[model samples]
Target: MQKAQRLLDLAALLLRAAEPVSWREIQEQFPEDYGGSEEAAIRKFERDKAELLELGIPVRWLQGDEDLPAGYLIDKDDFYLPDLKLPPEDLALLYLSGSAALAGGDFPYARDLAHALEKLSFAARGPGASEAAGQAARTLSAGDGPGRGEVPSMLEELSRAIAAQKRVHLVYAGAERSETTERDVDPYGLYQAGGAWFLCGHCHLRGAVRTFHLARIRSLEVNRAQPRSRDFQVPPDFSVADLATREAWEYAVHPPERARVRLDGPVSAEDRASFGPRAELREEPGGATVELTVTNGEALLRHVLALGDRAELLAPVRLRRRAGTILSELARRVR
Candidate 1:
């Protein structure tokens, strides 16, 4: 069984235990698995405890209190999920929605939602928690979709830090400067915009909320030794969408200005979507012109370059000339 499934089983057994159950009893119940030679069982149990703690599940060992022998169980009060009062029908609908999203790979919070659904399934199915848990896991892990090929290690780490309300230090490469700098960030949330993932957080270095592209984050380490309590609190009204409004060239830290680009053919859905709603399109004799408010000159130039002969930079005389000079240099080099 996967460790996740085994952990769920362990949680169930502990939650239902009327009193602290001894290690020997736990061994007897899970022989060939949790049950083993005395030393092996103890070590295995210790590892399991660490995993549960890491996931925010509280497991406590009660030292032979009263007349009872020392043993382990999840804190019943802490583990008790608030009654959501959703009937089986409601839960089934949620399960279907979650499963479809996972299969389609469009879900931004796939990992987080998958775990929540598993726990919810356990709560909703009651006596059938085992089957429901397994089903939920299978559904969410159906396939490796786009951007899911390598299992976004940094994204996972950031998600955990967000949940734990921990501060993190990031070794980030500046997009335009190509300089690496370390910054301490208090992550508020992770968001997916267009085709990329970004972390919205408070940057101590910048003294502001900044969006860091996941691809640009060279490394991250959570500041676990700060203190027992959380180092920062996301303002109650804070939202990731607030910081995610910038697009393409708009991400450049510069005064924004409008620029026009002419395309030789109809805009593709992919291109139109990437430009977002801020762009205005006007039809021309042979093609179309798109007006965009840009903050990053190079970003706009890069996009136009990617489109090759299909795109032309118009107006913003300076930017257009810059694009032309670069193109001319490329032509000479290739010749």
Candidate 2:
């Protein structure tokens, strides 16, 4: 439950209590197993009390009462939880931050993400979580990311397309180029990127695969969806982590390889900035093998080539040839 909602429960407890409760009386309500410092308990009371008030709970201090400087209570009617009207920026920030966490492989933290996503998704679905989500969309422009408008807007369309089982012709632009492709997509789900938004869906054109980086889509159109002969789904082994890319580069690499390379001295902090966190590194017997999930004959090879003797491509015959060709070209240039 959200802190806001949980505070509602606590306020209800106080309102139903027979008498005005002192801070100590409130602290004793928790089970003995909920052990913590006296100060911590008091601080929790203080914070939750304020939050409850913000929720329109009429929790307040009892004034002019001897030995009850911090006594608190609420009338049953005055203690009701108030509706919240969150601005769009807050909603966007909340969702983006949550989605990014799940995208980073922190599954344990997904519930919090799920909860926030639920609030927004539910608000968009019907009247359960709050009217804030609906009001939020109209209130704020861009919250955290300069590109946040893409998510709330695209998500509305994406969800509709999913339910109708329709195809959305998307205009996508990236390092590849700008072009529109009509994708009969079964929008399986949407997940967070590094503070960005992505939609995972099976593309009819690809036959069987998931795609992402919905924000980069410059244009989108909905069309009547063709029915699937078989039930379509993302592979069980597939995960958001596997599809993570800042630039929307989902193109398959040439092939997998075990490339060994030696780092000269310590790796520069500046160089570390280039290889993303997903790029794992293992120290080999002699040097190190930066375990990379890269395609064969990609720019990574050129990177290894640029490293000179400092790096050696030690796996995949395809990378070997590409390295050899690059080195041979470098030799000719040296002449």
Candidate 3:
């Protein structure tokens, strides 16, 4: 039998044994693999045991009492993962995120990630787990889109660079300009936003911190000189959260204006938080009115439109007029 297969069978036999499996039993199970001289067979077993230990499976030897014989066995508790009693909503989000990463085709560890998600689903217990898993699976399949053109190998390289605090050179496509430029960046971290992967880093070309979309990175090369050493240190004050949590409307394209918006229905705390930190809320009978500084009028208008009839832009007459004009145009298109 092949060494890999023999090792697998050995592990299975030890795991399934109610009591410690004797060495004689293991040899009998794989006679061919253990049929050489006694010393040679023992040497082979030792090698297999070492390999299993490296794989995180310890083959423990039991010193039996008078009744039980001395043997080897695998503790199920040691081999198996503990049950993660995650709430249904949290589990669903994990499932969705994993599925999205796989679907995006940019994540390098696709096979390993799939196995992990399977294990996550299996380890999930408690009420509503099955329902949540099912819902998440359905949601992922329903929303599956055409595969993106981003390279998975590049993403893998970037991940390595981030972990090692290494610098990278990139041929990046500009969003506004129809051109690509060479950039030398010290990568800090990678984040997912709006179903896309972005790299947050210190750009040498811009002489500042910048975020680059993974898809927009035409090509990249990690600084390979002194590969074992770190290229730069991430600043103590810099945080990926500050950049990742920013909403589209928070990206200042125009001068800031105090925009008032009325939410005429039940507003979730999450919704309120999306209005940003500067937002002031005044609660009324049925709903609440919010006043916040807006910098991206187009993004704010789009956000209000997504909320359907529940949200209305009350102040900033210019933006209100633009929203009205967009609605009118949309109505015309539909008709």
Q: Model 1 lDDT vs. the true structure?
A: 0.77
lDDT per residue for candidate 3 within 1-335, as digits (tens), equals 88888889889988998999888988998889998899999999998998887566889999999887889999999888667777877766776777776655666444455556655666875444454455445534543244534456666778889977989999999999989999999999988777788999999999999999988999999998997589999999999988997868779799888888999858888777767676799998889999888788788888888877888998789889988998999999999
Ranking by TM-score: 3, 1, 2
> What is the alpha-carbon lDDT of model 3 when measured against the actual structure?
0.81
Please list the Cα RMSD from the true structure of every candidate, rounded to 1 decimal place. Answer: 10.0, 16.0, 8.4
Judging by lDDT, tell me the better candidate of 1 and 2: 1
Please report, in order, the local distance difference test score of every candidate based on alpha carbons.
0.77, 0.58, 0.81
Q: What's the TM-score of each model vs. the native? A: 0.56, 0.42, 0.58
Off by over 4 Å in 1: 1-111, 116-151, 172-181, 193-196, 215-219, 225-229, 236-238, 284-286
Q: Candidate 2 — which residues are off by over 4 angstroms?
A: 1-179, 190-198, 212-216, 222-238, 245-255, 268-287, 291-295, 303-311, 316-321, 327-335
True lDDT of residue 281, candidate 1 = 83
* Tens-digit lDDT string for candidate 2 (215-262): 677777776545332234445786656566532221455554445445
TM-score of 1: 0.56
lDDT of 1 by residue, 1-335 (tens): 57888788888888888788888888888786776578887888888877887676778888996787788877777777666677767766766766665555434556766787787753675444454456558746764456554326576677778877899999999989888999999999988776678888999999998888888888888987854468789999897775676666888568988899988866676765556677898888978888989988788888888888888888689889999999999999999
Consecutive 10-residue window with the lowest summed lDDT within model 1: 142-151
